[model samples]
Target: MDLQAAEKRTKELHNLLNKYNYEYHVLDNPSVPDAEYDALLKELVDLEETFPALKTSDSPSQRVGGEILDMFQKVQHHSPMLSLGNAFNEADLRDFDRKVRQAIGDSFSYVCELKIDGLAVSLRYVDGLFELGATRGDGTTGEDITANLRTIRSIPLRLNEQVSIEVRGEAFMPKKSFEALNKAKDENGEEPFANPRNAAAGSLRQLDPRIAASRNLDIFLYAIGDPGETGVRSHSQGLDLLDDLGFKTNKERQRCASIEDVLQYVEGWQEKRPHLPYEIDGIVIKVDSLEQQDELGTTAKSPRWAIAYKFPAEEVVTKLLNIELSVGRTGVLTPTALLEPVKVAGTTVKRASLHNEDLIREKDIKIGDSVVVKKAGDIIPEVVNVLVERRTGEEVDFLMPTHCPECESELVRIEGEVALRCINPKCPAQIREGLIHFVSRNAMNIDGLGERVVSQLFQEKLIEDVADLYKLTYEQLISLERMGEKSVANLLNAINASKSNSLERLLFGLGIRHVGSKAAKTIAMEFGNMDKLANATREDLTAINEIGDKMADSIVAFFEQEEAAELIQELKDSGVNMEYTGARPVAAEESDSVFAGKTIVLTGKLEQLSRNEAKEQIELLGGKITGSVSKKTDIVIAGEDAGSKLTKAEQLGIEIWDEEKLLEELKG
Candidate 1:
């Protein structure tokens, strides 16, 4: 067929397939048979293959899959993805209602939505075409997963109207899909995912879009990124707008006129949660009016206008068979309770974390005791308490092991820490855990190299350290059990790609004591590279604002170790990138701006800049932006509809600036 004919045919097929997909997935009504849809899709695919240039990003055929990505890029959210404060009971719900009423008066209603037990994501559309999709990483910044999100058929490639907007949603796996996936995994002798939420998150994080496409994942858009831009006056209207734009939204949502109505909805859903095809951990209640929401504003981490009412965790009684101990990568010993097989929250519970010796003693948990087991967040099975009254003198108190379970070294408790530590640098368990951390998603992020793979490599003596991973041969990997040619190739590709990661990832993966991901990023930016960081003294490190004395000491002590020095050299020889490639914060000494050396707190609805944008600019001018107002805060930037922070700043006698003043200062 000619190019013009192929293009025409592809366009027609796209329109047809999009309509059919919407009917089946969104509307829950299939207008055509699966076979007919498949035929049309196949035709479009063929046409696209013939006329490659005619293939567009929004074409229905693109929903199937795309090329594998090397790494997910970081995306800055235009608006912060603030989490909701939780309400666990009717009283908590009433408290939330009271708070809302106190802030915005009793005239406001609420919109209650089922909080899907899945990963939170942000989707951005440009001129009605889906442009970007991202994981909610740190609320402000997230990982770009546009390719993987495109595979979900329910997500519209192009909206009905040409509008640029950003929306928040939960990406999930249906119960049927999760069951089928677990069944297949079980049949293949592979470990199944703990729950549908985890399965969905894992599937969406796949570097290969094809993997995500095959998972049968779905999304329910809940909120708009900016309601004012959409001209939506309330939360319910925002959801309606999403639906009108051909986006999938949960039909279970309802507008509650009062707290009693909200309570009724919550109770009804809690009882019916088990019968649903998807998982919901809680109900999200939000003040319906956008103007009221603005008035209520937000805290540092959560929105004041919204609250999540979590369902009571399902609990079951089980016999405590025994307790097992294990050493983690940090040399900290942890205890696990071995329970008699019992079902809890739809999963069989045989084990639960005991946390530490102190917790075990505090709870007075004894072996062979009847205990209440409940899944925390409907994911992890945990022992709530022991039924000491039911004990028939058979239960024996569990003693904390004096020695390390793996290395047989004497365990010692640190000065300020609770967990018993082995303190053995060469401990096998610690080494194995370290290797796993090195390949973790937030670290080197080597795809196809999970904990199991890391364990296998450690057991085979093929890898001793993170550096050894770069030296792996195809022959050695291919000889390992379950390592097929394709799998080996993918692993090798992932390993090769990881060599290019920024210094912060390497710092976090190194497992430096007391240094978390955020601290690593801060230190990496401060020093710029591994060489400088290694040479940095405690004083040098402590000079940086975020690095505390403990962190500084830890970093200095780590770099002073001969083994640590050798490891850095080995990693450097393996061609790993050690430089901080990301944008660094402006130095206070280098800036003459008015915001220099000032600790600024921002609050309320900014008409000019989003919270993040304002914060970034403030920091760039050498100002430190904190979340809350305190005696230490030098300036509080109050925008239109300023809330509690503004009031608090005024009460504290802290200097406050409006948006115009902030803008003027920024200009100067």
Candidate 2:
């Protein structure tokens, strides 16, 4: 298409996408299939690539996210996004009601709704289009996550009305989506998200919008940031406006005429919550009238206008039948409790993490012991306490293995840590673990290769070390049990693709002691090359910010070993990136002024720059991009219907800039 035609088409695509995004995210009514939406997006990408000048910040393609920012920008809200006081039970609710009645001395009504178990956010709109999004940071400032917010299809890109407004709500993962995400994580050999809250928070905070998009996030607008400004007189009126403006709001809201009715609503949900598709931690009871809300006002941290009536924690009892052990990719032995099947938090509890030998001994737990199990943080099954009085004589103490359970190598407890590891680098279990770690999602992120497949590969001796992964053949893979030709080909393709991974990934995959993803990134950038890092003294290594005494010692020890040195050399020889360059930013020395000490949050899209480029620009300007919004934010760069973050920023009276304005700042 010609430039003019391309520009016109891009504009048309933007409008169409905006309507669909609003319909789906805010209205919960999808007008198109996901596949259809994806196809349109692909077309837009192609058009933009062919005619770069035709792109704009509002384009749907720009929502995939940008590079990591050195800092988060601070944004002050127009009004404080006050926290709600919590009511643990009916007594607390009655107390709140009594306090409200005493304060006003008039008959009052309330709106009772589900308190979604998710991260709180604020969204701001100008002229009916989303302009900014931010977190509820300290009820004052917040982080900007425009790009990440755009990836949430449930979030409207535009509003139904032109009035500038702020809405506060929750960003959440539905129960079904949470389960699917956790299952996918488990299958990918990654740690499952602990709960719906964590899952939502983690997904929203991802630097990559693609990662956030994959998690299936949803949101619900609860209240307007400035209800009086919107000409809405009550909490119920705000919900009506939110609904009319195509904003997604929870449907379980009720107008309560009395405190008794509010209590009834809360009690009803306590039993009905499990049947809902999304997680509801409690019930939020709000004074219905804006006049009442203002009269009620707030405390330093919470609103007298609102209260979260919380439910009792979910816990169940089960018997510990036996202790089981699993070998990690690093050959670290972890003990787990095999329990008699019992229901806890709506799921059957058959096992729980014992943490380690120390925990088992400290707790004095044994087989045949009755244990109280609760979903720790409402996600992972955990043994909270042992019912010592119920323990029978049949219970047996679990002994820590003297050797590696898988390879039978003598185990040694590493000093200053809980893990007992097999020092044998060449041990089959260790090798398999190393390979799995190398290909894990947080490491090289090799798709299609799972733990079971890696185990089969090891058992068949088709490969060794991470380097061997690049050398696999279809014939060898197809020979394994349950391996079809297509599966084998896909695995090989994923391995081949992984060869292009940057230096940070290689560093993480090496699995050095006292090293994590953050540490690996720092080390990779500091030394610039694997060989240089290997030769660097502990003092030299500790000079980096994330590097410390324990980490340096571990890194030095890892490099000092001949086997590790050989493995590094082998990986280098096999085409893994051993030098850092692809995405490292210049030192804090590089451009340090107007942007200095500034924290900015980027949300939605910037048509003129890649997400990475935007991040680098912000850092170069001496600004930091924080993962979440908080009181420390300086500015929020927003795009589209930015959701609760924008609401938060407005509530805090934070200044917001659009993509066009942000681009100008970066360019200047």
Candidate 3:
């Protein structure tokens, strides 16, 4: 076909596909069947491949994703993405209403929206064409994630009208999408995300846009960045304008004329929340009038005109059937409460971590007692407290086992520690747990080596240690239950691939005491090889920043063990790469940069750079970024609305630099 015909057909296809996508994803109504949409999409792809120039940024084909990005660039939001103050109960909501009435004389209404449990993002459009999308990193500055955001089908690539605008929204993974993603992860022996919010955030932050596309993300545009530009008089109108412009807005939002009406709406939703496909942690109440919002104004961190009424954690009473003890990779005996199955926070709870014996004693928890259970942060199930009033005389006091349940070794509490630990090196439970840890996502990252498969391997005596994993043959694996020819091949390939991982993976997989993933990377980067790290003295280990005396002692102790040496030899004999392969950190003394040898702490919102960008630049110049304010901190880079960290630094007489000053120094 000619260029003109191709361009015309491409535009037609874009309109059709976008219309179908809007119906299917945003409106939850598809005009065409999946097969029809797929065929049309295929045709569009073919046309784009044949006539590349016809493919524009707004083309429906862009939703499939683009080239992988090395890193996300920093973006400055037009206006700060201010957070909202939270109202935990009805009293707090009334207090907020009182404050609003005092400012606006009770003349304003409120727009109540479901507080979507997802990542907050900013979308920008120039002349009604999608331009850029960013994260709400520190409010003032954010990371440019346009490529990833384009993959969400609900997000319109082009507006209905030719107008420049910016909007704020929640980018979310629906409950169904999150379930499917977790299911896939579980099948691949990967750790599933704790919640939909985490899954959405992880998906959007992926370096490859294709990964985000595969996550089945959705969005709800809530507010206009500059409502005045669109001539929208109220927040409710802004949402309507977003809908008119072909943007997805939450239809459940209501403009309440009175706080009583708002309270009723909030109450109604609390009961209906779980039935929805998406998660909402709270209800956001915003004064409807733009003028009233401006009058009420904002504080340093959050808008005073708006408040989020968080749902109280749903608590349920369940009988604690028994307490089960399990040994961890570190040999600590952790007690878990086995409870009668009860639903809390949208999921069923069968067991909750008791943490240690101390917690059990402190809570006065006993077997067969009625316990109040709740999900902490709406994710982890925990026994909030014992329902003493509901408990019967039949309740029995639980006792801590004197010996390890799996190994029968005597349990001893380490000095300065609360939990009882089994110190036996040859404990089967510890060995099994260690093997599982060794092949975890952050460790060796063996794809097909899940807990079940590892247990089977251990039980069969085909693999006793992490090193034995590399020695597995296809024939042996194929004989195991659920291990077909393809599955065995994939497992063997995954095992072989893990052998070539950098020294950090190997070091972390080893389960050395006090050496976490970050510490392992630092140690590996410093020594460059396993043999050098094995030979390093306590003092040698301690010389590195972030490696304290305790960690150094632990490292020295770990390497000095005869079994550790033997394990290393076995791994080496299995053709495992022992050298660090990641980028090396620059030596502090090597550069004359101002940041060299300085320990810096970043606080609050940076206007010019994303937190990561600033951190990368600082580290590149040999400065270390620590999380807290301390006497050890050489400098504090204070950004807008700097908080407790800045005050602490000031009290400590630590040198402080504003974002401007920091930027000046960086430029120099």
Compare the candidates by TM-score and give the number of the best one: 2
lDDT of 2: 0.78
Residue lDDT tens for model 2, 276-350: 668888998988888877888787888888898887888988889898888776666778899999988778889
Alpha-carbon local distance difference test for all models: 0.87, 0.78, 0.88
**Which regions of candidate 2 are displaced past 4 Å?**
316-322, 326-335, 339-350, 353-372, 376-380, 384-668
Candidate 1 lDDT tens digits, 1-668: 89888877877888899899887788665546566888888888888788889889899888867899999999999899988889999999999889888877889888999999999999999999999999999999999999999999889999989999999999999987897776444323244576799999999999999999888999999989998998889999999999899999986778899999999999878866765678999999988889988899899999999999988777999999999987888787878999999998777889998777877887899999999999854666778898989999988889888888888999988765567888898898999999998899888899999999999999999999889999999999999999999999999999999999999999999988777777899888888999999999989997775576767988999999999999999999999999998765676778899898787888777898988789888888888876556567789999876755787899899999999999899889
- lDDT, candidate 3, at 296: 81
Q: Which ten contiguous residues of candidate 2 have the minimum total lDDT?
A: 183-192
- Candidate 1: regions farther than 4 A off: 322-372, 375-668
Which pairs clash inside model 3?
Answer: none
Clashes of each: 0, 63, 0
lDDT of 1: 0.87
Which structure is stronger by TM-score: 1 or 2? 2
Alpha-carbon shift of residue 379 in model 3 (angstroms): 8.6
